[model samples]
Target chain A: MTAQPDHPDAKAGHTLISVDAMGGDEGPAAVVAGCALSAQANPDIGFILHGPQEQLDPLIAKHRELAGRCDVHHATEVVTMDDKPSQVVRTGKNTSMWSAIESVRSGEAAVAVSCGNTGALMAMSMIRLRKLPGVNRPAIAVLYPSSNPQGFNVMLDVGADVRADADDLLRFALMGTSYARNGMDLQRPRVGLLNVGTEEHKGRTELKEAYDLIRAQGESTGFDFVGFVEGGDISGNRADVIVTDGFTGNVAIKTGEGTASMIGNRLREAFKYSPLSRLASLLAYTSLRRLSKKIDPRRVNGGVFLGLNGTVVKSHGSADATGISAAIKLAAQLSENKFNDKLAARVAATLPAEESPS
Target chain B: MTAQPDHPDAKAGHTLISVDAMGGDEGPAAVVAGCALSAQANPDIGFILHGPQEQLDPLIAKHRELAGRCDVHHATEVVTMDDKPSQVVRTGKNTSMWSAIESVRSGEAAVAVSCGNTGALMAMSMIRLRKLPGVNRPAIAVLYPSSNPQGFNVMLDVGADVRADADDLLRFALMGTSYARNGMDLQRPRVGLLNVGTEEHKGRTELKEAYDLIRAQGESTGFDFVGFVEGGDISGNRADVIVTDGFTGNVAIKTGEGTASMIGNRLREAFKYSPLSRLASLLAYTSLRRLSKKIDPRRVNGGVFLGLNGTVVKSHGSADATGISAAIKLAAQLSENKFNDKLAARVAATLPAEESPS
Candidate 1:
């Protein structure tokens, strides 16, 4: 097993964060608040808010301490989260998001965090940083809000690519395994192919072929191959890592998030039913508040774009200050763990470097 | 709009529930407890537990009140949930699940409920009772454990057939709309097609074609077309009815359920960290208990196999008594609403009686 390298930021005494200041629903306010909070939390961290200085000047003034740590770069345009990734990337030059991507590529920052269009971030990251040597496809590795070390199931390719073949899936399994080991700090992560059923015969024909290939190369692969895992196992924490195509993974994650939100809303509504219950809601507010904090959407908002040459975290467009702050912290932590270095090394050593997508 | 019909169960003094006793993981115990609870809660609904009497007798004796409401129909074997639907129906003679399905076919019971293999239930139900006159395919409808009127999101197939054409999806939409009107008493329930995105260019070729068909027919068909809904909307209660093929729907639901279970487990772990939280956990146990009860899996375990000529509700194989009871209630409710009658009428009016598979 290869050891992960330390981050360049830790050695420099200045933690650099590349922020797409023009991203997300609230735009500059949310991003600046996040930058301020992160800089305050870790004095060592300095944020290069990649957007227009004129638009961000007011936000930087709110946090006096962060004023010194936060500097605004002039990238005039912004990418809407709803825009088509390929179309936007082709047309969007010198945009705040694209500039942020360049920061990571130029080694101006340890990590780039964006809350803009997921597709744009992915396309730009791949184009600028390129894929790790030998990785055919770069999967967007997600850490679901989980319990055990295995609780945080890693769902690959949530949105990077949709129409993947068997070879793409196998490559995802390889990338996903390294991600689980280096990012989550799990040894020999139990890798399971996400299927409708645990039975090998179950799932799409494409999945079946991928399963066979995994089985044929099963022993030689360093991952602790756990055969097929049913959908239920995703939340069960039985498998350390789960792999699936972006189409399915995106739907699965969205479904999970929508359900949790709906349930949370229902619970709130339930508590508001009567006067006595209303009072109970106030008295038990702290407990419920704490519970909600643990499951905060902002905290779990970032998705690590794994299998890339450098580290990048994607946040939700609707994220608020808390979410933005969490994204910054997450990017910092992922960079500090030397997640990309470890991932690149693993892909290079285990598979031919030239196989990676350009 | 079609007026909702009177519930069939309401006409009879004793509502007969045909139970596939041999079905499911816990088998007799699960069915017995479910039947007992159902009978205890709704005295009008009686049960005919169809299986080997020798196997069910002990479980029957455990609840005297349920014994008064229950009877035994001796079918020595069961159709395993793992068996292929076509093979099991052809080879498994006198299987309790098959017999239970037959009971509904012959009008021996008001409704039939099973926790056995879904494929077998779909096969037996389609072969015995048949599809609604103009319905090309039968859809499995479940209450999206997330919805406001607590209205159910009707997803067809749910795993009965893997590949679906445009016509199959359209059939699912029509059947699902009728089900919402009849089952949930919604007037012109909003129908949304489950796709990767809401845009015209968002889905695959088949889905794109289905989208066009839905737009063309929705105005004349009485269903309020809400346009395309992504997986994120499934649990947001965004639309009263959601339509998708058997494969994606099954994976989506399982993903939703798995996520809920995983998050619940994570909360429990997070609360274990502190002395204050542990003490609060004990005191807030009642509130948490109430919350858990409200979101109980047992309350919504059974999924309705829609578009069939008779009422057939499939419970998860791992269903506990709560899940079984939910299935029983759904079965009873469908019988009362005459769900099949309403769906059959709608299909005959809107679509052609015989259509080729897409």
Candidate 2:
């Protein structure tokens, strides 16, 4: 993999992932564990754990094997979960989340990873790092589990643009398509608008507008427009790429995550209910394991914030070392490929020269 | 359970159910199975299955043990999945779907259930049954599995009203509250509006508008308005009932369903990957069985269409006999309780008598 030539610091040929140690529910424990795990697994990946020195020191000391290799950018404050996204930049000026995001904006880090409040992280990324040219909105792209044996499906705009217009959705489709091609290595991704039904006129006013815009783009948009996709469509890989507004996307993603956990808990509950189910669980062992790998959260931990000037990955707030390790690996790949720049350039080429501004 | 004395059809005494035999992917089979299962369970629950006689005969015959128990009304034609809701009602006069709906309008059936094209069903229900006296728009209500071991969460308007206003949401809240009270048998159901955040001013325009309207009703409305809830709020059963527009609610429910299945499939895949997991699955047999039951679709097969004059349940089109059975059971319980009448009266009492109309 090679970074895009247009990337500001692509010629430096180095990968430094800034970790927001103050982010996530479990705080520094999970963040420290994840950073150490990533460092141990990938010798080439470097980390900058950003947080208050006093708070981060003990955790770093516990993982001395990674101490000599990792760097810490001491940040005094933290961004609380309840804080509004608009207030994140102002109130937590010295917070690790802000600094980590700034690190990427300044080319000090290849990517910034946070498990903090998604809205704050998104706000910081958009305001500080800024969006790539030709992209009106930067989307939170998620790789959802597909029923297909091939691989996962990618969708974007998962809560960044709540009141998204038709043009915004059109831009999201373009960005998602590029992300799939550049990030997931798909040649030409199939894109679809999330709707109540497949019919063009079946959606709400906003969705109807999006349907028309997407349809008007035609084959010239690069990605294959697969028409409208319903909620059930996500079960099967109906489209390689799906685009929806952030509110729906966020709800959908969280629902997916929560449902996964809920199902696991339910499965456990079922197995414990009676001796018959216990025996059934035993009989279904082989098939069950196969199913787990297909929908494992660890395997799908990293969520790329697309349409940004630089690549940024957000891991699950409740993620463990294994999940974090996967996130780092994903970030490393994004960095090496300079995925963001390629996506930006592709979007730019599609827009009129007079309308394109970089 | 006995019918409400105040209910208009209380004198009739009989619990009449209208089954759309032509609805569902498998047509009469699903509806017939549902009716048979429901009839066998509740001797007082009567069904009017509307469809072609030849097709309905075998389905009803399969449940011949309940021979004198059920009736099948012959409506020769059927509605195609792709047919527009407007087109179906305007042209398909003798269609099974329309005939089934007509049974409810004619006061022959206390309740109706369908698994056909959702749009067509909703359109027919609103047009024929009409919204309850004070209701402006009817909403689809669904039960979402919560992390709480006790019960699943109830969400209203999963896709019935696309352009719902503040007044429409208030009506949904009133309807949903009755569902929890009469249907789920909860006292003073905790109501909530699904939002991006818990803050009053945080959500989009429509949500904010709904929030203000719900707040204005306050405690006097006979509903315990529990304030705002996020997507994650559903997991913990933070509120007994949650309200949102049809578009978001539908996407949320479907997303949850797809995710639970995906995760279950993933776990199955994992167990088969190696001997260790296979052994683990066996040792964890009791846990696995419990989990299956926790996420079982049969347990939450039907979604009630709230704010209508009659109790109507819409099951998944692809639901099997067990799922259909559950839907039928839900329909019977709802009809016996006169859920809609209670909701409408409560809403009407809360609003000025003259201002109740849309």
Candidate 3:
């Protein structure tokens, strides 16, 4: 957990970013290449790369931009995709995933980004960074591509924890609101509680209780409460921030992704069906590219660990260099904006638990 | 609630299908037109129409196929979309929805089809026809367009009861399997319990319990249990029938629909970007049309209420004539197969509750 002397206290204006260069579906090569992409894009950012030093050094050396900006942490062990979260926490002391979070926990890195096992990353994050004050459970917030003017919306509790009580859902609303404001640059994000229906009497008793709590916090929290929104509204323009329990949120996002993938496949098949259509595909190349870009899953890559003491962005396991770059961009933005500090202060101030004697 | 004498007991081979002619967004005109389309396509199907006599007579008269075949039931009241299920059950005795279900309950119609409030339809169906023995909860089964050979898969508990216990999910598995067999004509259908992940130790406690229960019933119940499936597998080829609690299933389906709708819109926008692209759209017209029809929501419009004494198909509230016709087609198919009888028998035989002491 000791700080690397090479980074040298972020070099005045430089932002030190920690990254796990192993455990992704793509090897340390893609991860190191991704770090180089982030390094080349911004001169203000420096990297603390965690993996086998031998495997990471060559990849980092190949990129001129990362030659002097990168620090290699020698982590011999790798926490695999199949490894259980609890198992990883106990045995993952020498793993790259643990060392990456350790940099953020030690305050040597402004943010930590990993394309590793999500469950293990979250588990390690909670243990190392700990929960923010007035937080019972942490949540994973992701940017969902939407029809909004910003072209994306914030959704929370994608899978940090499967269960969320009424109070926990209220915390997600506030956390999501903060994410939209600082993470996405929304001044006053509109928040909505995800429910089976928009009606007041619909869904479980816990959801109804959460609805009232979120609505009550609207005026004071400086965010618009859109009452209850359904699954469709997760991508709709109605709410800038969508809040739900991890179980439903996880299912909703995956369903959206699967549907998007299916439609994209069908579109390609449609274009390949006939000779003339194939030619047409060539003619409409730019337009099709534009559409694909608009709905690209990689464009909105990164699941942020919310309600934690420090910022952590969990990239997709199979993320390519581009996807990894997207996640690093998010982490840098959050670090620069000091999103975690603002979120923690907001949670402590607004949480009903702070006001009550429980 | 008496059967009209003019129909004369389904004319030996004719299937008497009841339908609510009001409450849909398009009104009674679309419903009658849809009935005409179904009646025109199928020779052995007769409709016992529900609505006001004056309002229904002209619509029925407009379609020559229903000249002597359609029997009208005078029910002045209509269940509006805003009306609650409990309110409808108490004061909706004269409503068309009630009359439509009554026809099925009174043994005059093989199946009941309604494009009204779903909650009301389910409540009325449960009260009128009642639940089959050993069935704790009813489910709404829907067909999702997928990569399967049948081009679709069955998903149940779409929005029947929001909360489903482990036993209820097991019931959903049986009912979904029955639906896949009879409705989609898939023998030895593969069933999967929907979860956040396919891993054995993921999701809620009820889900894990449901997984073991469903897997145990595979051999005896005649279903190929593929174990736990994630949201992505809802449209994947891994399983023909996906089972889950109504809350998660409802969200998953709606999210899929929303994503599909967004993709379709983006594709149109892509084609209309420029004059040359417009020409390309013209050349690719047939291929694109084929793709659209394949993913068209109307093509799989009906949501069948399972675990009831009689089958009831709940069509989309915003359905046009085409959507209504699709729902009617599904109702006819289930009626012809005697799907409700088989489902009831299946539940009585396979339910663990049937074998255990209370």
Candidate 3's residue-wise lDDT over B186-221, tens digit each? 989999988888889878898888888888899888
Per-candidate iRMSD: 3.3, 4.4, 0.8
How well does candidate 1 score on lDDT at residue B98?
80
lDDT, residue B312, candidate 2: 75
Ranking by lDDT: 3, 1, 2
Where's the lowest-lDDT run of ten residues in candidate 1 chain B?
B1-10
Candidate 1 wrong stretches, greater than 4 Å: A1-15, A216-218, A272-289, A352-356, B1-15, B57-71, B81-87, B126-137, B265-290, B354-358
Model 3 chain A poorest ten-residue lDDT run: A1-10
Model 1 steric clash total:
5
Model 2 segments more than 4 A misplaced: A1-12, A64-68, A216-218, A274-294, A353-358, B1-12, B148-150, B267-294, B353-358
Candidate 2, residue A261: the lDDT equals 66
Chain B TM-score against the true chain B, candidate 2: 0.90
Per-prediction TM-score? 0.89, 0.90, 0.96
Candidate order by decreasing TM-score:
3, 2, 1
Real contacts recovered, all predictions: 0.43, 0.52, 0.65
Docking class of 1: acceptable
lDDT for each of the candidates? Answer: 0.77, 0.76, 0.89
